[model samples]
Target: MYRYDEFDATLVAERVAQFRGQVNRRLSGELTEDQFKPLRLMNGVYLQLHAYMLRVAIPYGTLTSQKMRKLAHIARKYDKGYGHLTTRQNIQFNWPALVDVPDILDELAEVEMHAIQTSGNCIRNTTSDQYAGATAEEVEDPRPYAEMIRQWSTFHPEFSYLPRKFKIAVTAADRDRAAVKFHDIGLRIHKNDAGEVGFEVYVGGGLGRTPFVGPTIREFLPKEYLLSYLEAILRVYNQQGRRDNKFKARIKILVNSEGVDGFANLVETEWNQIKNSGVDLPREEIDRIHAYFASPKFENLSGESKTHKAKIAEDKEFARWARTNLAEHKTSGYSIVNISVKPIGGIPGDISDIQMEAVADIAERFSFDEMCVTHEQNLVLPHVKKDDLFAVWSALKAVDLATANIGLVSDIIACPGLDYCSLANTRSIPIAQRIAERFSDFQKQEDLGELKIKISGCINACGHHHAGHIGILGVDKKGEEFYQITLGGSGAEDAAIGEIAGRGFSSDQVVDAVEKLVDYYKNNRQDKERFLDTYRRLGAQPFKEALYDAA
Candidate 1:
């Protein structure tokens, strides 16, 4: 993790003092609710259905063990005894007193984290694969670049008030775990034939009322001009991106209105003038940032872990957890352990204070004091030694965090729909719970194979329903809850939007409809093909037939 420099520290400290004053004013009536709206939003405070909700940024989904403890502290003191990890790789406190927000910001400042740019139409947190540095396939760590972007975009005067919120994602591996295709700006770090590292920049990608997979603006953007080229794209968006209607405000809408070629041309023309500017990355500066992300001190050890195998064989429950929760780490004798938040019949991403403390303790004791928040809304102990698997699992199980459903159907990604979000059309959490409960059997889930069942409460697609093997999108028809299903969608290297399977299903019919679809896939699938592969082979026709067979 990149520690805050003097400049970074000064800026955040100042912002806290500034917001403190603003909050006092609002409470004292010096500023009316209308007057304090933008100021509060800039600080990540939201006036939700019940009380105020504060969203704190976890930049690029990276957090130190200490930072995690601080967040848990904040949750314990200021808000409720729990926090909801959002789909955008941010942690949100659902209940916070409006007056205590400034205090919360101060606490976050101490950890080099903040709520700035978390809300508002400005550039939001730049996200990446939660397993970035640890992923075996990655060419290099992507966090240094993500941190660089965070510094540049923080309170950027030129883009403080864009037409809508801007999101950027970066991925270094061939697998697109960061959902680069669905971001306002997506960068895939790659090396060309010359072996010089650079980016494959994609622009005009986003999901909302309209969804668009970004187009490549530059097939290969040189490493030197990363910031300069990014500035060019933002400049174009600031100048010409839609502002007349909130519905048509995202960069994706602009790209859709003006073809991808036209948008790319505009970005290129702007970039040509700023190619050799001072904004270009200097080698020394790059090295300075990269130093923070150097590989952890790893001991040379054999791939085989007799201790781990022994434990797995000794305990049946531990064996079950080992099957789905553990992942291959870059270093030998270590594994990336996913702590699934989506226990059957439990809320998808809500973690209580006890669970938080348990996770923090495990990370400190067994994982060398580092943890990560995954985009799938799960917690990760990024570097757990294989020898510590059983002990960690026991600790996690004590806190009810030992669900062995990492990528299984029971592991669902659902947005805080009508239950919490003001933008949601129908309740998503309950629907997710129902789905998880529907597949309560662990062996049945494993037999079903890897399947991503994502549900978004609305068209904004916060849950990334469009990218799921089986996507369920909630809609409202005459004030009644309805869902639209899409199949064959993926957010990987071969990214594509899911086609709607058929007509919408009412809330009452949704679970059965999903069951029908899954059953159809299972019956028709050849060999051990996954849900996605089966969808690809047979297309949506068979699923549709099964879903609406009586109709």
Candidate 2:
């Protein structure tokens, strides 16, 4: 919800002009692909398998109807008719022409959006919980802090080139909807016994070839000192993180090499040196940023709406959607509504231009003219009144966006794998679609209960498979596409990496294997237990047997 100031507008405008020149130079044959690669990446352009992909940053996953409309227009006129919402809460235009990228960026700049820091080895977009201001269970909305970090990290001279691409996530709630545990730097804003707001910081957590839950580097970092402490962590990683090999360049790798205690000690030493050296955001700037995020004015409706209850009683489809896709709102008579982009066999994170416009219109009319993109690749209307849920549901269904499968088996997180990415060994979207279709039944998915199925094309873990209750990683087995399954991983407060079940499955056998695991969970789970709980209690052995013995 932060608006661009003069400085922001000027900076973005200047960058667009600069990139336009660069693109012209490339088209004129003054630069080769190798020469132009880093330059384009700096502007969030990627050379995918078939075409150039343009990733636009959605800082902290916040969007306005105006911005959404701009995005839909871009999708319609510039690239394909759709955009892919990524796991990092950014949107990717997958089929843009190289020649038209500058024009695309110009359109983006019109909406106060850009692609800076969305790619490259620098600090990428800082993601936060989608329900930042609307949720009831947060200590404070973490978006302002995330915005503060975004401003600080945009083009910091020292960290412009990190050892690897770095990620940071912020969350204010006990339930980790932002997957903070899997980020390089994860900050949970909370209050101590005295009720002073501060961040519980974790460092070196990431998912990829090597996945690990970050260790708590600081138990309680004072709210004002957040920036300084974060700089300290990045400073240590910049100085110590491996750079010789891209595979081992992540901060998590460095943290694992040095013991957690030793790593924390290094960060502490760095902090002692720079904690008060004027590195923190100015107090006025902090207040200015916080002011933009002031809560929306709400009517004095103090209780739940009878209209909502009546609708749920009358409409089973609406009721089903309410059960899975809605979160408790901090304000009475309001709900945080999730718009799942995943249908029965649809691509996981894709939305057509028409769908985008429809959701934008829905957000504008029903919500407070605000929309959000979740880290799990879904849209959100963060402040919808409960009374409007039925209308919203009806509109969404008409646009084919009403999928009552948030957090269910069909609500999967999958990356565009071999179909798009040049780095993938196997296709992921098809697998995700197949798996979703396999468990397409809404009642059956509800029976399965809170199962997370994540599929990544490669070890890079773009889909965050390592953090799923059922994680599937695609790999090349000779010439065939094989999936390695892992169980019990989570991105919640009780974060843990999933353990691998023995032997990879071919694409043909993968869905059946997943079904077998679900079946075993259904049969063996204790009263009302979820897949993760059952897997944790019994370990991966039972699931492993279920998958392979049946095969």
Candidate 3:
């Protein structure tokens, strides 16, 4: 929703020109592949197993219908007819030709989008809750702060090349929809006892080979010092973080090695010197950014819509979708509708060009021309009027985007594993597809209830396997692909890293193992307990026994 000013536009244009020159040099043989590797990565271009992949940033997961149309155009013209939405709320074009990357970047720049800082060891796209401004539970919208961090960190000379990649997430809601605790720096916006707005800062949270739920470093930091505090954290990490071993280069490793108190003291010492510096955000600037995220106009209406109720009564399909895919909105008579990209047997986050265009049209016609890319690999019309729900559902159904499986077993989150990623050990998409097909029945999925299954092709954990209720990790064992399972992981406010079950399962046995665990839970759960609640209550022992020890 934030438009680029002349400075922002000029900066992006210059970067595009630079990248175009770089691409031309590589193509012309002036630069070898070795020489162009860093350059390409800096521009969010990666040479995958099969082709070049381009990742475009969608800041804080917010986009206009116009921007969505531009993405659809790029998917149609430059890459394959589809784009993959990543766990970070960015989109990936997996098959862009090396020569056409500049053109793709040019198209993206026209819509104030780019792939800058999407892949390199600098601060990646700053993400927030998809329903930041529209939800009633949040103390305030977190997007403004996320945007401010984005503007400050883009091409910051000090942090351009850290020991490892950095990520920051912000959340203002009571629920942690953005997985803030799993980020390098997580900021939770809250009001103090005196009613003044501030942040609760968490440091050193990340997931990879070594996963950690970041510890709270500061209980209350005033909003004005956010930039200064972040700078302090980065400075500490840059100076102390490991550079010799890439495996242990993350800030989480440093924090763990030095203990949370030691790290916090270092950050405090650094912050003391720069707390009042010019980097501290001025009140006017904060207000200006906040204004850009102000709520859209809504017609006065009752909390419940008669037409919506009537439509649900009339259409069973619409009623099911409403129950599974809709969230309560702050504005009365308006609901947040989640469009699940994970249809049964389909790739978890892949959206075709036609589907993208259809969604754009639907957002423009019914959701006031704005949409959000969620961390759960779904699109959201955050302000759809309740009265217009049925029409929107019909339109989405026409494009095959009306899957009513938001948090069900079929709505999986997975990475472009061995199918696309060069670093992957085994295929992830097929496993996800098979699992979805296994639980294809909507009634069966509803019966399963709020089950999150996340899979990663490797230990990179790009699919956020560590945070799922059922986490599956693919591994290479003597040139064969196998999967390891973990249970009871969560990414909400009470974040916890999942504990692994006993032995690995071959690809053929993995899906059946998952099914067995689900069935065990269904048979053993009390009342309406979700899979995660049951797992936590009974611990992983029972599930592990059911998965491996059962005859």
Candidate 4:
């Protein structure tokens, strides 16, 4: 909902022109592929397994109706007829020709959108809670602060190219929907004992070949000092982080090598120098940025609309969809609706061009023309009225978007694995599809309760397998694909990395292995306990015994 100012418009236009020239040079053979690699990466272009992939940044995952339509247009006009929503709250078109990328940028810039800073070692898109403004229990909206960081980090001279890419996430809700603990920097906005608003800062969390749940360096940083503190942290990492080996170049590696206390001391030393050097935003500027994220006007209505209840009673199918898809809203008589992109046995996070256009229309009509993409690979209608639930469900069903499997086993988060990614070890999409089909029964999924299954093609952790209740990572053995499973990881308020169960399974054996894990959980869980709760209460021993001992 934030409109591009004159400065923003000019910056994007200029970047596109510059990238166009760079693309032409590579195409003309004036610059070799080695020479063009870094230049193209800076503009959000990547050389994937099949072709070039253009990752367009959707800052904070927020999109207007017009912007959403343009995305559909790009998918239809350019490469394939679909786009992949990634774990970082951005979208990737996996098969764009190198020549057409600049034209794609030209199209995106028309809608005030671009792919700049979406790649490279610079601070990537700053993600936040998808339901920031619409949720009922948020301490405050986190988008304004996320926007502040985005503006500060964009093309920042000091930290543009770190030892490795850096990521930051923000959350203001009671629950950690943004996966704050698994980011390079996670900011949770909260109130102090004296009613002052500030942030709880977690640093050095990341997932890849090596994974760690970041440590909390500062328990409470005053909101005004946010930028200065971030600057200090980046300064420490930029100066001391490892660059000799790409594997150990992340801030997480640096944080662990220095020890948590040692890293905190270093950051403190840096903070003392520039905490008052005008690095932070002024109060008036903060207010101006926040005004763009103000809540829309709502008509006061009582909770639990009678019309919604009546429709639920009249339509059993509608009631079933509502049970899983609708969430509580801060405004009375409204709901936060999640449209799961993971249709039964379909590819996870892949939405077709027509589906995209349909979602745009639904948001335009029922949800204040505002929608957001979730890190779980779903589209959210953040401000839908309770009385309009039936109509929204109908529209979604018409486009095959009503899946009723939000948080169920079939609602998977999978990267475009061997099918698309050059770095993949196995085909993750097929494994996800098999699992979804095995658990395709709606009643079975409902009985299984809140289960999150995340599958990654490799150790890059693009699918966030490290944080799943049941995690699967693909590996290579004897020229064959295999999968490794982990249990009891979470990305919520109580964040923790998952523990590996045991040995790996073949591509054919992986789905059965996942089912066995679910079966163990379902058979042994206490009353109303989730899979994570059951796994935590009991240890990995029980699940491991159920899996390998049976084999």
Listing every candidate in turn, what is its Cα RMSD in Å to the true structure after a full C-alpha superposition?
1.3, 0.9, 0.9, 0.8
Worst 10 residues of 4 by lDDT: 542-551
lDDT of each: 0.88, 0.92, 0.93, 0.92
Total backbone clashes of candidate 2, pairs 3 or more residues apart or in separate chains: 0
lDDT of 1 by residue, 1-551 (tens): 89999999999999999999998999898999889889888889888777889999999988776788888899899877999998778999999998888888988998889999899899999999878878788888899999889988999999999988899999999988788988999999999999988999998887666778898878898877889999999999999988999898888888877788999898899889887778777899888999998878888878888998998888888998899888888997889899999889999999987788888888888877778888899988888888888889989999899998888999999998998888889989999999899999998998898899999999989899998888999999999999999988887787888889888999889999999988988898899999999988887788788889984
Clashes of each: 0, 0, 0, 0
TM-score per candidate: 0.97, 0.99, 0.99, 0.99
lDDT of 2 at 372: 94
Candidate 1 Cα misplacement greater than 4 A, ranges: none
With a 3 Å backbone cut-off (N, CA, C), the pairs that clash in candidate 1 are: none
Return the number of clashes found in candidate 4: 0
As for candidate 4, its clashing pairs are none
lDDT by residue (tens digit), candidate 3, 236-303: 99999999999999999999999999999999999999888788788898888888888888999888
lDDT (10s digit) by residue, model 2, range 338-421: 999999989999999999999999999988899999989999999988888899999999999999999999999998999999
Point to the candidate with the largest lDDT.
Answer: 3
Candidate 1 minimal-lDDT segment of 10 residues: 203-212
